[model samples]
Target chain A: MTRITRDQLLARLRQEIPETTPWEVADWLRDGKEITLIDIREHEEWVQGHVPGARHVSRGFLELQIEMVQPDREAPIVLYCAGGVRSLLAAHNLQELGYTNVYSMAGGFSAWINAGFEFEEPRFLTPAQRERYARHLIMPDIGEAGQIKLLDSKVLLIGAGGLGSPAALYLAAAGVGTLGIVDFDRVDRTNLQRQILHSESEIGELKVESAIRRLHDLNSDIEIKGHPVALSSENALDILREYDIVLNGSDNFPTRYLVNDACHMLGIPLVDASIFMFEGQVTVYQPANPAKGIEGGPCYRCLYPDPPPPGEVPSCAEAGVFGVLPGIIGAIQAVEAIKLIVGIGEPLVGRLLMYDALDQSFRTLNVQRDPNCPLCGDNPTVTELIDYEQFCGLPPRS
Target chain B: MSTIYIPTPLRRLTNKQSRVQVEAATVREALQALDEAFPGIGERLLDANGEVKRFINVFVNDDNIHTLQGLDTPLNPNDKISIVPAMAGGTVKA
Candidate 1:
């Protein structure tokens, strides 16, 4: 309305707002300063590249989403754009909303690149992906960004049996990009009672082979890898290295300890679940990764240092699981894996969730990180994966 | 009186009963009482040293006994004690 040109307006705002150069922002981030970075550029510009660890809140949505990102008005916040101009506007708007410590990146992403600073290329959801993950996108928890994460994540299932059946189904349905299934056993009629991923028509077929066909029919776009071999300590580390996370549904002590030790060594979180008769247990064993800032939890060895003496505990086949137990437990494992991938919700690390179907109750017990744990403890032991079968007191595989 | 949740594996020892009640003041006493009611359960839960086997976890209410006072953890009235053993069943193995 007033006779002010764009240059004149920019000059006036420059004096009113506080600004920090890309060098200063880099120093703050390197020093681990408590600062929130918001990229106030359009979606296209942001997907190309942006300041690493910056939240993308386009200029149009800055006012709407700023509160959710930074509730404390006095907290340090930095906003950047393609250049430095839009960030100034975003900072001004935030100030009007009573933000007291907002700073604009002097030259935005352009300045960051010129300064030879790091930038991250964010993955975006395609139009078809947008429609497919529309429900997830609508939720504030798992938006477009989170949907992209699900697409880029790879999850490995230790088995394609009762628990793996439902877990893989939901993980695939949720659009997890890569699903690797390791199972040497073939589908038997007994498995059909609960393993929904296999059908009666597919009896005697290799479980991994049957699983690939079932998952393809469910989601053709997703990649399904079949490792039709037994998972041994010899191969666990190599196979687990390819996955972002592991879902353990293994039925034997040798495999459980093997997978657990391998995951800990790799610093990959494991969503471990098991069913016995009508009862089930679910917990996440996350090894501490100091570099990535992931807190450690009580690992499998911490909870169960050694397997029950042989013959004292009945085998799963003899235990006789209920038809619906694995369904509930496996779905929970899938949910935990998704949470890990999207980085949302309070993970079940350091806690064991016990489900008693007969009583219709869920119980959570705290699992402590044993200071004397042999695998993950103050003093180091178990430096590498060992013979799980011999350790479990079972006959070694020949 | 406190309630001890007998896991499915131990159900056979407790006459196929899932929940067994015990009258005791400490976890050790409760487990002892459980043994008196259901013979052979003590052997299944305790090792040669009369302590919970390394593979088994004992809980008082929502906390593991290891984090508390171990088997000496005191139990209040109607408190729930759980004896959890690591289960490895994921498939209907033959």
Candidate 2:
């Protein structure tokens, strides 16, 4: 049997496969029809820009990963590449794999842009920002649009210690427009082991102050708001209202519950992370926004209804955390926060990511909304923020 | 026998052992075995109704038991079961 050349294969597949113009696909998306658009490009091309909401499966792994992405073979699937060639081949492969309604975009991404169809690209990047985020701008996922979203987004971090250190650094470096840090504690000598934001000279300085200085140094363009006051019921809502999302880096149960309730009430996404010893966990608590295409998902309260009795759970100090544990978890929180702001990729709204550094393993558990949750449940009894310190068995703040 | 990997928070209950080998055919029995070897372990995992607690997740060979048969999910020998609790700690230091 004679093996066909690449050109011959392309010609043969083109003859049988149907092609859809960029305008037609754009109209389908605009009309809110249920269709799956896939980008079969390399990672470099994908990060530069892609059709918003289009799932990316590189040409090399299309066969391996397509089943997981589009399980229903009968679903309408559109594939596009830089040019039309790669996606045409990918569409042919999908058809061969029994995908009944597969179509290749006639002119690929460039043609889509030429036709003035809505495509996602990095826009409004200044020379400095473009240079600073060159790597991100080049990425199809975090290109100009995603970078702009990061710059336009506001994120409040609950604590400026362990988890907050890495999260603040990365978010600021990633060019998050505004960062609000809530912390009243001073940087202690012990914090130097894990809190990278503060230096030895800054010991005894307020954490929020140190964080602001360090984060500014990292990215002078972004604004850093240092709230050097302890977050309490009196000011939690007011402080949180200014931000689009909240990151819970507080260690105590009271603050955890407080942040959760505030974010849930405000209907803002919360990227929550925790680390103790060699273990860490990260999850995003994004309440449903039907208008934004986000399905209603569980909040933190849905996972752990009530805080564990104060003594039942140990803090990082008591358990003696691995120095780098928060770095790992906090970085993940930054990733989730960026993804949420950019509206790209799957956020961890209904999933729990557990990492055990000692074993070098990561596990994600499926989390669902609890109808009985007091805060976010179907019959939520917690319409207002209460005294979380008392609820978590901690002494009321003086 | 299935190997159960314990999370750090629960290591104290298991005497700091990260992984424990237990002879059991189901997830429930494995929990019972863990409790037998280490007292009070079952209480943390199951509720008053003997159901897996809402906050706890038990995975059998990387597949969530919820998607499987819940507590009755059959366990084959050499399977790995991971018991993870809901982690909520966020403070830098206590």
Which prediction has the highest TM-score against the true structure?
A: 1
Q: Which candidate number would show the highest DockQ if scored against the true structure?
A: 1
Models 1 onward score TM values of 0.82, 0.71
How good is the docking of model 2, by CAPRI class?
acceptable
Native-to-model Cα distance after best TM-score fit, residue A13 in candidate 1, in Å? 13
Which ranges in model 1 have alpha carbons more than 4 Å from their true place? A1-41, A44-121, B90-94
Error of 2 at A102 (Å): 35
In model 1, pairs of residues that clash are none
Candidate 1 Cα deviation (angstroms), residue A56:
5.7
**Candidate 1 Cα deviation (angstroms), residue B78:** 1.1
Candidate 1: tens digits of C-alpha lDDT, residues A196-268: 9999899999999999999999887699999998888788889999999999999988899899899999999
Identify the leading candidate in terms of lDDT. 1
Worst 10 residues of 1 chain A by lDDT: A309-318
